[model samples]
Target: MASLTVQFTLRRYVARAYWTAVVMVSVFGTMAADVLHIGLGVPFAVSTPAFLSVPAAVFMLWYPSERTLSIHSIQTRRREAFRWAAALATFALGTAAGDLTATVG
Candidate 1:
């Protein structure tokens, strides 16, 4: 969240702000998945598909509302929200899948 605040504050450093927010969200996403499985005993088998469905649901809602999923077309707040939701879901999905693979295979 702080990284996103910085992203808005520094317009000239767009790349740095973007990357920082990405890294921050990714770290948080991994932590969230870990907490669900390790801290809350969710089980990777469940979490992997659960997290995967989140992005799918997001896209299902996003495309109907926005008419396009291109990152290049993110000129509105609505589109930005969809993009961020997808990103966080994707990162969490990846984390859950990785844990599932490592534990099961």
Candidate 2:
């Protein structure tokens, strides 16, 4: 049916948008973490946990408010916003953690 087709198309668009946001956030987050250390002269020891807590705090708030963190449950604009925020935080945390290990070894 035409309705089914429209729904499918919408879902595809949403998925695309989600993935694009994730990739862009990841790239920018990594750049930010790097800049904090390399450009601002912040030590890895201080920055690693600082970057990590962002995602932790996001999830803490999101989970309590939304009751779930599953991707399949992201059905509303608010949920989508939370998902993007969490994604950005995770990417930044990952970048900082990776850089910290590299610096240590």
Q: Identify the leading candidate in terms of TM-score.
A: 1
Error of 2 at 96 (Å): 0.8
Model 1 per-residue lDDT tens digits across residues 23-90: 98899889889999989999999999999999999999999999999998887767777887898899
Clashes of 2: 0
| Backbone clash count for every predicted candidate, in the order shown | 0, 0
lDDT of 2 by residue, 1-105 (tens): 232234334544566554555567778788888899999999888889998889888988999899999989888766766877787778888888988899898
Worst 10 residues of 2 by lDDT: 1-10
Give candidate 2's TM-score.
0.80
Question: Model 2 residue 63 lDDT?
Answer: 93
Candidate 2, pairs of clashing residues: none
Off by over 4 Å in 1: 8-13
Quick one: best lDDT, which candidate?
1
Q: 75, model 2: CA deviation in Å?
A: 0.5
